[model samples]
Target: MDPKSVRYISECFVQPQYAPEESKQPFYLSPWDLAMFSVHYIQKGLLFTKPPPADEQENFIGGLLDRLKSSLSLTLVHFYPLSGRLSTRKEENPPTYLVFVDCNNSPGAKFIHAALDMTVSDILSPTYVPVVVQSFFDHDRALNHDGHTRPLLSIQVTELIDGVFIGCSLNHAIGDGTSFWNFFKAWSEIFQAHGNEACISQPPVHKRWFPDGYGPIINLPFTHQDEFVIRYEAPQLIERIFHFTSESIAKIKARANSEYNTKKISSFQSLSALVWRSITRVRRLPPETTTSCRLAINNRSRMEPPLSPDYFGNAIQTVRGIATAGELQEHDLGWAAWKLHEAVLNHTDKKVRGFVDEWLQSPFIYQLGQFFDPLSVMMGSSPRFNKYGNEFGLGKAVALRSGYANKFDGKVSSYPGREGGGSIDLEVCLPEASMHALESDGEFMASVSSSN
Candidate 1:
């Protein structure tokens, strides 16, 4: 429960003037972007020390608004596609949509300011981090796959008793996790530099790439025109951030590799296996049922010549590892981890090319493993994304979080733990019943620590 909620103050439109060079233009949506239409926004942010005295707070916030607005516009001059909307042709067999970055017509990103009574710890330290994270977002409209007329990005600033929260909500169709962070990093540089254009390290490359013969995947029996609306019922789910120290991770890796009789087991695979096995056991799923785990893989390096790290678009695809509940229950942790390792190993250049070729032929390939699949779980986001390192004038973030939309059952995202020694923190969301059961499951609780 959000024992306390963020008080909505005021909201305003932050329209960064799209550079004049960029006229009305349409950016193509890659199959990768299309597949991300229904998922939650890539909500990430940093917590900073509270504002100065009231007079200073006003000056601080006003100065921030000015710098953010102008710097963002300058940022958009380079990453213009982000300042536009998704235009769709519903008449097409399987509705086609193109990203529009028309500066004149686009309503630049939305910005809002709000406040809450709780400090950072109030939100970060809970067994299930509270859903109040969403109170910080002005998620203007429903989320959907079709490229509709909606702001491509939204930013929110929230004041706490002793800290500030900067939340960014970017449309999933425009980019993947890497692209999302890249935009933030670039924008932050400009803001911290006091709007110095010279501060931008690498201007983003907004052009999207795809193989020839690319077309939308039509008639996805599953691709109904689904609209994602936010409905808040009393909390029926749990959201918990669990930290596993380097020592624990090392032990898990050792056990996994020893069990596999090889040094091939990776930290990710070992951790995923541990989490999957733990959650599966605590949930007490039927043994005969088959379950799957989905891993979001970045395809940038997998491409033949490799896409530039600066390629700012959705460059990710999901890889799935599956087994029977019986197998997961019966296998040793290493065996379970091996399954995940094998999936990672399967992501070869050839395999990635085949995927791109397949997407070229079929546009609507969505790997939304069964939504809330009782027998399945997924691990997204990379531990490599050091969210806590993102900073403005304020010090490094004391904590970071995903939006409250993360309450979907069986969904988990991993972040690089702030301790900096190859540690891992997981934001795990599961059903209310399963989460309660998880709290009491000794094995699952054995390695989890309260780092926030």
Candidate 2:
């Protein structure tokens, strides 16, 4: 009855429907790519699915998997970076050689066909998704640029008696959330169209670029596989989704605006502020503890000259809100919200431009290494991306999941719910004790409409 108890039926590689005209070519990965070496594939992976009607049977999974594989096959031709492999640039020079995607050697992405005897409801009903979200992965060198074995993208489709589950993992060195959803929208477009269209929703841009005065690529600090993964330390953390209704958000927004005596306060600022304060209180950290909240800012629009909307690569820069535990817990939601609002506003064009320049000089390492800190939380994944866009003729996704990698402590992902209503889902991953306190915190729970 549990999804984790699901059994594997078969596994195979699903290469591009047609190999690229260009082979044996290596695409450059910028300094931003190297900075992400530690963060790796975990945050890049997500689980997608649709609810099953009562009449659907288990055997239908086979046919559905075929459709997924075929659709992905066609999709990979356009999203070739996903089907490629990472090749290390063994050079010691700046802009280290470890930063590139080698398309010549690797075959297509890995696709697995699996089955779960349990119904979808059994797994979907939990407040926190179980460990099964990490199961059925193709662990063959997926984290590094070592060989031709790892696919930049690996997918698994697990068949449940009631419905199907799709797990997709993308290599961070080659792409980010923007790239993932962009590809997804296009994939669903062509798949739903039954391959009748010649052009994809948007052609991908694979070329990596740098500002005129920037030079010398930044290399990752660690070269070894075991050491590389160490940067992302995992703790015994559980995840839960807190759904805030439109009314709740509106109320928070008003309060946040009133706190600053400014009539303008965005929904994201208010909600994120509340989360920062609530978590700070629940943890009951020392008054003098240094606390911070990091916003996942996209460089696409923030760049001197904005990148193409279709720019396909990692283009995010994190800006943090600094505070003391005493400051956070003592403030009203509006106070916390204003802190977040000002932190983001503090980024100037000169500062945003300096991001890459500074990274190349002394690369900005991913914070996953410091994720265990008791006084910080990295707020990421904007609700702007249409998470519910890809219908694929199977109805919109009932929900989308970041899977397990993001379950690391101090990670929080916020997204709009599939329902068009102004509701938001704040997926928080914290230790069991902290989660228990958060679950019972009345002020926090008062704003939450549901947790599932």
Question: Considering every candidate listed, which one attains the maximal lDDT?
Answer: 1
Residue-wise C-alpha lDDT for candidate 2, range 1-452, written one tens digit per residue: 55456577787777778867754466667776666665547333334454444255544565567777888888888788788887665554432335567676776788877776665566669878666655635442234333235677877776656555666777766777788788878777877878743648687886666767653343565444454454344788888888888888888898889878897668988888888888888988899999888888877776667787788888877887789999887777777787788877877668876777776666554645564465788787877888787766566666776655544566789888767578898889899999999898988898898887
Q: With candidate 2 superimposed using the best TM-score fit, by how many Å does residue 147's alpha carbon deviate from the native?
A: 7.4
Query: What tens-digit string does per-residue lDDT give for candidate 1 at 177-205?
Result: 88888888888888788777668776777
TM-score of 1: 0.89
For model 2, state the Cα shift of residue 422 in Å.
2.5
What are the per-model C-alpha RMSD values against the true structure?
3.5, 3.1
The global Cα lDDT (0 to 1) of model 2 is 0.71
User: In model 2, what lDDT does residue 91 have?
Assistant: 52
In candidate 1, clashing pairs total 3
TM-score of each: 0.89, 0.90
lDDT of 2 at 187: 77
